[model samples]
Target chain A: MQLKILYFGMIAEITKCSHEILAVETKCNSNQLETVLKKKYQQLQSISFKLVINQNIATKTIFLHPDHEVALLPPFAGG
Target chain B: MHKKKTVFIEGAITPDFIANSIAKHQTKKSIGAHNIFLGQVRADEIEGKTVQAIEYSAYEYMAELQFHTIRENAFEKFDLTCMHIYHSMGVVKTGEVCLFVFVSAPHRKIVFEAIEYIVEMIKKEVPIFGKEVFEDETHQWKMNTV
Candidate 1:
């Protein structure tokens, strides 16, 4: 399965890319995918971010559905 | 359902735009009080580097949804006649206004509470991010303490 991963803020800066499609095993959940990504991108290991699945913050180990849009969002600084 | 207003503006938000928003509300006679919150970029010296500007970005699709949610919640929770929220994207220089929140209500107390609630929600819930650029072109991510 392929998941479209979106990166924002400092996460994007460290990743050096905004969005990309990643091929992963079908059974992988958001947490597992995050671990893989952190291992691949060493910079992410030191940065704090939230994984958003389908516009909502992902808190548990839920399977990644193909239709779900995923994003790594850093801390908010809006006023 | 209320129609969503444009929240993101390119570059810094101009003072004229805020004045125009105030001017557009003259006919709203029922609104007895109006409160405005403007967030200006500060030139803070960090580790001997002076901050020069802020470059903002966001998970735009999600930010829009969050803004809509905040607006709806504010309306339900407060006695507000109307509210306007504008945030800047791209680079906003030091001392420039990046956020302009305008809230109107029948009473002064309501506008105050409503503005605080909405601003806090935006700071805590929205996925917008800011990169603080220093005078020598170095940058660091800005985090909201709240």
Candidate 2:
């Protein structure tokens, strides 16, 4: 299955792309995706971000559902 | 259900607009206290360059959802009469108001706490982005370190 990923704030700056669709195999959890992302984009390792599934923040150990809107959210600076 | 409230404004929020908002509330006899929090764009000196302005952006749909949720939670936890939140979109110059949070209640205590909590939650949860543009025309993305 494929999951659509979004990058925001400082994470988008490091990744140099805002959004993309990444293909991941079935039964692969969120941890595997994080590792793959860090490996693919080495700059991502330097930044801290949250993984949001369907607009809700999730932990690294959480499972990824293909139907959800997945995104990488950097720390917010809003008031 | 209440109508959808606007949380975003084009470009920057003006001091005059904020003053007008405060003026509009002057006649409310039930409001014993009105607490407000305004976020101003800072001119930060980073890497020997000074920031000139900040460009703001957000995932609007998600931001609206988050704002509504915040409103609901605040209303539940506090005895507020009304609340309003306004944030700028696009370019906002240094020293300009980027965000305005207003809370009114019958008394002073709850308004203060509610305003603080709402501002804190917005900073932690909203999908807003800021790009710091320097005087030299160079720019860098801004993020919360906490």
Candidate 3:
């Protein structure tokens, strides 16, 4: 499965890029995805952010599909 | 749902734009009350550095969706004649307008309620980010404090 991952705000600073494509097994969930990301980008482990799947906030247990849209969003400062 | 409008502006929102918006609404005689919420960038001292400006960014696809949801809910919950939201996308210097929320209604009460609800939601729910740049050009991410 190829997942399109997005990074924003401080998280993007750590990731050094705003977007990426991840290869994962179809049975995987966001929790496993987080573990993989945290290992790949060590700075991500210390930051506070929310995971969004397909434009909606996602829990760790949500299943991921191929070509799924995922975003790691830092704390919002919008007004 | 109301037709979606472009919410992101390239730079700081100018007073002339605001005044033009107000002028355009003069013909809307049914709207007796209009409440506006403007968010201005502030120069805050943090760790001995003064924030001189904020460069804003966002997951724009998600932000527009969030705005649409908030707009739909406001229309359902309030007696509003119209609502317009404008937010700055790039650098907005200290004291410049970054966010502008305008809600109009037939009466004052509903406009007040609508403005509060809409502004609160935009701050809490939208995925927009701001990088606070210090006077020396060093930067840090800004976090919304609920």
Per-candidate TM-scores read: 0.98, 0.91, 0.98
Each candidate's DockQ score against the native complex? 0.92, 0.60, 0.94
Candidate 1 local Cα displacement, residue A15, angstroms = 1.5
- In model 2 chain A, the worst 10-residue window by lDDT is A56-65
Please write out the lDDT profile of model 1 over residues A1-79, one tens digit for every residue. Answer: 9999999888888889999999889988988999989997988898788999999999888899878899989889886
Stretch of 10 with least lDDT, candidate 2 chain B: B1-10
Among incorrect, acceptable, medium and high, the docking class of model 1 is high
Model 1 alpha-carbon drift over 4 Å, by segment: none
lDDT by residue (tens digit), candidate 1, B1-146:
67898999999999999999999999999999999999999998999999999999888888999999999999999988899999999999999999999999889988988999999999999999999999888899999999
Give candidate 3's error at residue B78 in angstroms. 0.3
What TM-score does structure 1 among the candidates reach? Answer: 0.98
Give iRMSD, candidate 3: 0.5
Candidate 1 displacement at residue B62 in angstroms: 0.5
Per-candidate chain B TM? 0.98, 0.96, 0.99
Question: Candidate 3 residues A35-68, lDDT tens each?
Answer: 9999999988888889899999985489888767
Instruction: Give fnat for candidate 3.
Output: 0.94
- For candidate 1, give the lDDT of residue B74: 94
